[model samples]
Target: MYYINKITFSMFITITLLWSITLTRIYAESRECDHTKCVKTLADTTIDMLIATRSVVAKNQDLINVDPVSGNYYFKGFVPAMVGSEVANDFSLMTGHKLKQTSLKLRNPNNAPDEWEEKVLRSFEASGYPKGAGFGEALVTGDNKIYRYMKPIYVEKACLECHSTKKNLRPEIRKFLEERYPYDHAFGYKEGDVRGGISITLPFGN
Candidate 1:
């Protein structure tokens, strides 16, 4: 059972309160902002809402500083790469922007990387590539323009429950993966291996 302390309970309540008036809160906060800044703020704050809701770990809720573009967050658990396609899809639909959790070793076809993303993924796999550094670019193709940002996700010790070597993967987890993701290749990873990347695409200036 997950036990909540005084601080955790207060945080839980805060998340509830924040979610209750999400649209209103967001609109009020971004109302005076310019277009690009508004969208970025919306995305950043929405991700804050997501991390606040999804994090349920006990003990210390450390404030982790991430890319300034992505914004900072206080999450008790791993929220970066650990957030799945479901959350990414919800974020995209809610914000009208693109959020993708993709991998070269795709477990789901829906999370397959595009050509540009594929190149980025390969670069992430390179031994000399700087770990945890994000790659971003603004591209213009005729009138269709976007800013693409990708941050690499690494395997952690906790991820081994399902993402370790075939023999080491728990029987139940392996069975479930076989049933749900028959073409799963998101395994055989040791700690610190580049798992994949979280790619965010914003239209125009955002």
Candidate 2:
């Protein structure tokens, strides 16, 4: 009778510990998913708007015009790169997570790729821009505390204003880009070429 009671007590303790551990993990995952869902929504919406703007501009060149003298122009109060940089900065400021566009051939020095970003871009290229594959995800810092999302950006005719080769670029546009981004490597891309991507980082559980 004494031996049976001792065995029963041991089994009860073991089950309690297991249940506690499982609950902890479940809570952690729930927190992480909440963070990921928020970031994913923002990132996806921003990319969709950016792509839609590109399409609109491609269909109508006069939608946006360059102002070499003032070095600023607006179409509905948002320029392409301006919109990207603004959204990234604002989101990072508000949420404490980072979001921005990055590429192997980066035009803006600020948009330079991080380690994981470079790897993802290489994967896309090596895969020959496989159909229906436009995003990548991974954990950062060897921990599940943070997650990354990347969405591809493709070149459209509107992009050629600043992204075309020397011959294709307008003189004024080329001059503006050269003065602004002297180290720009984000040119020479044709329609349908994968230009780069919008990357978003989110912090999971505290």
Candidate 1 RMSD computed on C-alpha atoms after optimal superposition onto the true structure: 9.5
Runs in model 2 lying further than 4 Å from the true structure: 1-46, 53-61, 66-79, 138-144
**Predicted candidate 1 versus true structure: per-residue lDDT over 83-163, tens digit per residue:** 445556755676565777788997778889999999999999998999877776767767866666677777766556567
Error in Å for residue 180 of model 1: 0.8
lDDT for 86 in candidate 2 is: 61
For candidate 1, the 10 contiguous residues with the lowest summed lDDT are: 57-66
RMSD of 2: 20.2
lDDT of each residue in 1-206, candidate 2, tens digit only: 01223333453355345434533443344345555565455445545554554445354444334343453542222236654576557546655667677889988898889888888877766756674254645465765566676777778777776677877876766666778788889878898788887777656544
Error of 2 at 66 (Å): 7.4
- TM-scores across all candidates? 0.65, 0.67
